[model samples]
Target: MEVATRYARQVAVIGVHSPKFSAERDPANLAAALERHDVAYPVVADPDLTLWNQYAIRAWPTLVAVDARGRVVARHEGEIALPDLLESLRPLRGPDGFVAGDAPEDASGDEPALANTLRYPAGILADAARDLLVIADTGHHRLVVASLDGQIRFTLGDGVPGLVDGTGDRVRFRWPRGMAMLPDGRLAVADTGNHALRLIDLGAHTTETVAGTGEQARHRMSGPGAARETPMASPWAVAWFAGELWVAAAGTHQLLALDLEKGTLRPAAGSGAEGLHDGPLAEAAFAQPSGLAVAGGRLYVAEAESSAIRQVDPATGRVRRLVGRGLFDWGDRDGVGDTVRLQHPLGLAADPDDARPILSIADTYNGRIKRLESETRTVARVFGGGDREQGEMGDEDGVGTAARLRSPAALAVAGDRVFVTDTDNGVVRVGDLATGRMNVLRLEP
Candidate 1:
């Protein structure tokens, strides 16, 4: 987002995408991901890790500044403040610095079209009682509200990627990712690209920024920053449990919580370190925790980069890893306890009707939907399987064998059906909780 915002400032921004998963190496998938993120800058796919190895980069997101003579000036590993970065580039913009190109500074093109069909939808919220389904049409930069039977109703955002607050169509969101319904009839949104949390008042039909200062936080913070004052770094998913809204701050490698009643934001788990460690909330560590779900009294987090599922007890401030071994150990092997394996899972959904806890995981890199039994601590692939292969839309539908999925990013359960955002294919899939049969859902304009 910062790169896109600063593209017109006479500074060159190059996006070097070095994918960790084999599925992401494909040119089509890489293009889809870049488009989904709304990266308007020039980007190159480092499939063979050539660029990464050349630059000696180790982190998933690394920034490097270079002079016109091709000498490295600055390099930062994780998230950083854009204002500070822009300030540092001012000196280079002068006559004695890097030469300006002949191309236009505002390289970003016009906004894309708005349609009922989704493109790279990442998050889903299912209201069973009201029979309403809300999808985060991320690539299109809008939220699609439709009935369970597929009737398009309310559409949030004007389909333009931006950060504007208003009611209904007037409101804008930049790559909104996750959503959680609040007890007060409002929806808490992880407005990811904008680095902020937005609240959607269902009754008032208005949207407002409640958390984050609209800038990504550069460093780790404890509890000093208030709700609207503090900045957030790539908040991926959110869940409402107990009395607060829990956020999976992926870029910061930690879990943050918002005191709904008090309207304050604080770090709830992890110490901003990227690794797999389990202990107290403040002492524990996480690696890109992306998806969050609440079951019973504990919060289940899907650690994306580590391919792990973790359990967090808010009352006792205890954090423990339920599955996955480490950051590098990832595969499709399934077993009990430490033997279980998952490959870069991004979304989780707990079964609300079951007394025994059960979570559905979107194992993205493996192109499968897995089921995790909380009591037994066992992991199994319930649907979809293959080595970085996305099957056809209905190829595995109604077959007793493993169901096929194409980079499923998010899941939502309503009664016996599990709704999935098949991101790579740009469609929604419904899987039966009882039989594991899958089907594609189409939304008409």
Candidate 2:
């Protein structure tokens, strides 16, 4: 993200993707990942590790800077600090050091059908009473309001990317994610890309910033005094429970809570470290928790980087890992406890109709929907493939696993039906929780 912003024209960023898994080799899958990340540069897919061997790269993320004449100038392994990167490029920015080059053709294939409908929708929310559906249209940098029957009601953000507060077309957002409805009929938004929280007043038709300083948080700031003044780092998803808004702050690797009634924000879980350390809230660690579901005083976190499911007890301030083994231990396997594996699961939703508590997972990288019974502690695939099927075309309105979902991201439960943001397909899919039949909901305009 920094490189894309700081060196858009000064440097030509070429992503050499050397895949560790076979599923990452597919062009469509790679394209979806790049698009989800808002990457505009051309990326080379090196599935056979051809580039790895050529570069003699043994580490996962190795940065090598080549001069204008194609001579290797600097090499850094692992995460490089932005300041250090800038210093390394300082000497190479002279007139004789770098030169402008012709722009390369965009290799991202044909435009998806119904590009106007949605582009990589990330967050899904439903109000059964109002028959309303809210989607965080991530790729489009907008919010889409529609009926469960696929009728467009109102659109927010004006389909533009920026941080602006207003109403209707005047309001703007950059890759906004997760949304939670407050008790007073207001919507709290995790404006992920903008590093802020936004509030939408539907009745008044106005939008306002409730949290963050409209900038990314570089340092940790705790307590109520720092909450509104401090910048936030990628608030990915939010949930409202007990008069407080819970946020999955993905970029910061922690959970935050905004007291809606008091209008104060503070960290709720995680210690801003990336790992699986289950313990008290302040000491517990999480690896990029992208989705959250709160129920019965427990917060369910979908840790994307670790491919793990963890639970947090608000009253006790304790966190425990329920599923997934480790960061590198993820595949298309299912079972009980740590034996169950999920690949980069993102969004989670609780089954409202179930007598016993149940959670649905968007096992994103594996392209499947999974279910876990909170009481029995059993995991099973409810839809899509248990194994990765990269090139297979999705069967819309198909029954059971026959109905393929391309990169399902966020889920919203409305009675016995669940709405899935099929990110890769750029459409919303509704699934019957009882029968496991999924059909695409067509949106006009």
Candidate 3:
């Protein structure tokens, strides 16, 4: 985004989306994703992978730089640092190099204000004990705290994207994602876009930076370092387990651990490689792990890129795959173990009310909420699902498979109800776990 803004006059950025999942091929879903991410540039949806085949693209994100005359100039696979990218483009700045144009007009000013509505909420947590619902209003760059009945309690951040630690509205966050409550009642946040971890004290209305250097890590592998000194790479989700905070470092394709007592950060699992290999912590690989939950005395990960669920043994640092086949195997199918298929699931929560370990999943691409029984190894749809042709797969309240959702990113189970961040729809949805009935949660101040 910074690159596009910085070189707007000299560069014309166009996004070509080659979807890996069928649901992503839907024009509505694609449009919703663009808006949710605040993508200003025009995007071409290559649902048939025409562009992928023509360009021989082998990765999810392959940047192909085309010159003003339409000749391919350079190409890069995977993430690149902004500074490096800017430096590489320096040669194409002068006359006869690249064309310049006026900046695009901002169309957002014409849109009506949606003060009470969430803008692309990405993560949610329901504290049954406290009767509180916490939401990561990702696009708005704020965290909202509300009562279970939809009454506003308090909030964190000032609706701006940055890295600042202070009290209430004085604090700032950038596209915060998953959250976990500390044993002492403080809220731990994966300040994703800021590449940092933050702590929120609800009673004090204060926020503190616990880890990260407020900059994205350029390197793939990161070692133990002082919490505030460590440069993190897109810490997407966080979970508290065994006296440590576990982080799903999505950009690095690894799991990280933060020791609150020692105030240190270290890699916990994955070797910074992007794949579906599982074994010892150092040798194990992950594909954009985006969600974390603790269940059955183990940590479960939502591996988004592979559309898989994984289990990690905290005692031995051993990783194992629970569901999904590989990077290409994805769908909206339910069964047991490896027979089940998920489409880029991103949210996971352990059911606190169940005696046996049961996981609630926000199957993002499938637009559904699912349940996984740890003991039986059975997967079942809990809510969501509808007809795509009829446009029923988005922003509709119903029961069971009749309910509609668009890219539900995160969910939390609170006793008899489940709270979901219907991300692309920009709303928080609440569902009755027993009845499968779902409705949009209207927040009120």
Candidate 4:
């Protein structure tokens, strides 16, 4: 029998995040229990645990009952008997207002949000030769290349801002992200913090201006920030595919493909906008597009605000929804099982072997990365769901002081080696793909 006579209304609520309320975690026959009682309201199938991270779910099935006025009159944790559930409602009919978590400013002047930080920040991947691993150190505003053993092999931007490093003397990158090794082993960077993308020389440490002709915000991207009529505006993510480099322009809402040899870009639609496209790809635009990757002629993009995963038809430049609707709902923190709503996500990649064509997404806000199977979109792996700086990183380092991740913005994988930026920790961390284990690269001053 349905609880037809029970409470029924759209109640504003907040709940826990991913780590504590993982979807892959078996519910202990919770669904059967709910069904036995005929309770419904779509208790929210949040596989990624977005609500768990948001409300900081202290207790399982914690209850916060709000009155008709949107105030929380009663909050009970654990299982509340029906009589008590009704007893807690007495305040709703009274004069007392509901209780809200809104509080006064904290002592440090920092607004309180999630109670976690970054334990790992950067992820690394390699080329065909495993000659190098690339990292986008956004907070530091630089792109780093390291050895297989994690040594500082090379650094780009020279700690200066500019598209061409010393060539222009003014082409600086702001919050740089996304790096790809071209067929020739050259590196392409999405300098998000700087509003431009640069191509770096792996051997010489020289920076080349590839797009967004200017170093600042510009609506049209021609070549670099210094150029006119270019389409790049705050490019955040990049990918190399079929002899072309693709950039996800977060500012102007577009996907740009560049000829690595020619360094020229053309707008790509992936899938036509709205429904049917009768115009050029440039006519189509992405909404807050953050991360991009390509495999088997298909393009996968992560739109943060839209909270969706989309597939791009490379032939027509048309884009279509593959996962989220960009609504920020609760789902998967990683792309492994079911995709989840995110706070902000910034990385995407497909396994190179073509055996599975699996895609990996770094669900930054939920503090983990998820792997999804190809085309079918089933989750294959989920890791790093607890992205807080716990004062300690990598169990092997033994710094174990409750360290959590700060905000991991990017990721890269080669073999079983994974890398993280540890944005707040101000160092790059390393992990093993086999055991889901972690170790710090220790990039501190």
For candidate 1, the 10 contiguous residues with the lowest summed lDDT are 386-395
User: lDDT values of the candidates?
Assistant: 0.81, 0.79, 0.86, 0.54
Which lDDT value does model 3 have at 165?
Answer: 94
Which sequence of candidate numbers ranks them by lDDT, best first?
3, 1, 2, 4
Model 2 Cα lDDT, one tens digit per residue, 299-390 = 78899888898988767779988888777788877788877888888999886643577899998877788898766668888777623433
> What TM-score, over all chains together, does every model reach?
0.90, 0.87, 0.93, 0.61
Per-residue CA lDDT of candidate 4, range 268-330, in tens?
A: 552313221223455544556778877778878877655566777658755566566434354
Q: How many collisions per candidate?
A: 1, 0, 0, 83
Q: Clash number for model 2?
A: 0
lDDT of each residue in 1-445, candidate 3, tens digit only: 6557656877778899998878788898888888877788788989999999998899878888877787777787888787667656665667564443554553432342245668889988899899989999888888889998788887787776788999987898888999999999999999998899999989999999999988899887557999898888999999998789999999999999999999999998899989999999888999999999997689999999899999898677699888889999988878999889888899999998436889988888888898998777789887888743222366789988788898899999899898999888888989998787999998998
Alpha-carbon error at 140 in model 3, in Å?
1.0
lDDT of 4 at 369: 54
Off by over 4 Å in 1: 1-11, 87-115, 386-402
Best candidate, lDDT: 3
For residue 189, give model 3's deviation from the true position in Å.
0.5
